[model samples]
Target: MKVAVYPGTFDPLTLGHVDIIRRGAHLVDKLVVGVTTNPSKEPMFSVAERLEMVRREIAEIPGNIDVVEFDSLLMEFAEEQGATAILRGLRAVADFEYEFQMAGMNQQLNDDIETVFLMADVSLQPIASKLVKEIARYGGSIDKFVPSAVAEDVRRHLGAGSR
Candidate 1:
């Protein structure tokens, strides 16, 4: 089976992420979404909370998709999951520079697995989890960047009124 790992912090699952998840599922027999904690950034949701939210967001996707939490090196985690490829979503040239370097490093670590990059849907290209949380914390409507359910979760966490 062709298994791929799409790993992200997913602090708040944005519409862009959902777009990638749906499209990524079609390219592999199983798409494992890894929710990893980034030590550099503080998270609004705990790993458990993120897992539940991710599960709810992907419940209806028509494929074999599952969410798991991993704290080790991504390549090692991908290997553990039996993934033949590591999937990523790109939105801009800036993103490409970073992802490209990371992909190259991962390849050096494990030449057996390939890294695949998917461009985010044009309309959702600007949506990012960091910016979504920043907008919510400052009282801006984030409905455009994330799903209604996710927007609500952000608002609730930030103690803001509904949009």
Candidate 2:
């Protein structure tokens, strides 16, 4: 069975994320969505909270999608999880440049594992977790940027009214 790991902070899983998850689902037998816990950036949601939100959002996806929180190197985690590849979503040239370097580094760490990059749907090409948080932080509507459950969480956390 082919398995892939998709790693991200997912402070607030956005529609763009869900889009990639759905697309990545079709390409692998199982997808382990890793909600990375980075101490460098203060996260809005706790690791468990972010994992729960991602789990709740992808519960309907058919291909055995699961959420886990990790703090160590992602390539190491992927190896331990027995994933054959790391799935990533690319929205623009900037994303490509960043992911390319990371992919190269991951390859250096684990020669067997490969990185698969999926292009985000054009409608969501400009959407990002940071941008979504920014919009929510200042009383902007996020109904279309995040799942209904995630949107609610962002609203409550950011102290804004629901869209």
- Residue 86 Cα positional deviation in candidate 2, in Å, after optimal superposition: 0.3
On the 0 to 100 scale, the lDDT of residue 57 in model 1 is 93
lDDT of 1 by residue, 52-158 (tens): 99999999999999899999999999999999999999999999999999999999999999999999999999988999988888889999988889888888887
lDDT per residue for candidate 2 within 52-85, as digits (tens), equals 8999999998787878888899988998889999
For each candidate, what is the lDDT? 0.94, 0.90
Query: How far is 157's C-alpha from truth in model 2 (Å)?
Result: 1.2
Instruction: Provide the TM-score for each candidate, comma-separated.
Output: 0.97, 0.94
The 10 consecutive residues of candidate 2 with the worst lDDT sum are: 154-163
Give the CA lDDT, 0 to 100, for residue 36 in model 1. Answer: 92
Residue pairs with backbone atoms closer than 3 Å in model 2 (clashes): none
Instruction: Give the lDDT of residue 73 in candidate 2.
Output: 96
Number of the predicted model whose lDDT against the real structure is largest: 1
Q: What is the lDDT of residue 150 in candidate 1?
A: 88
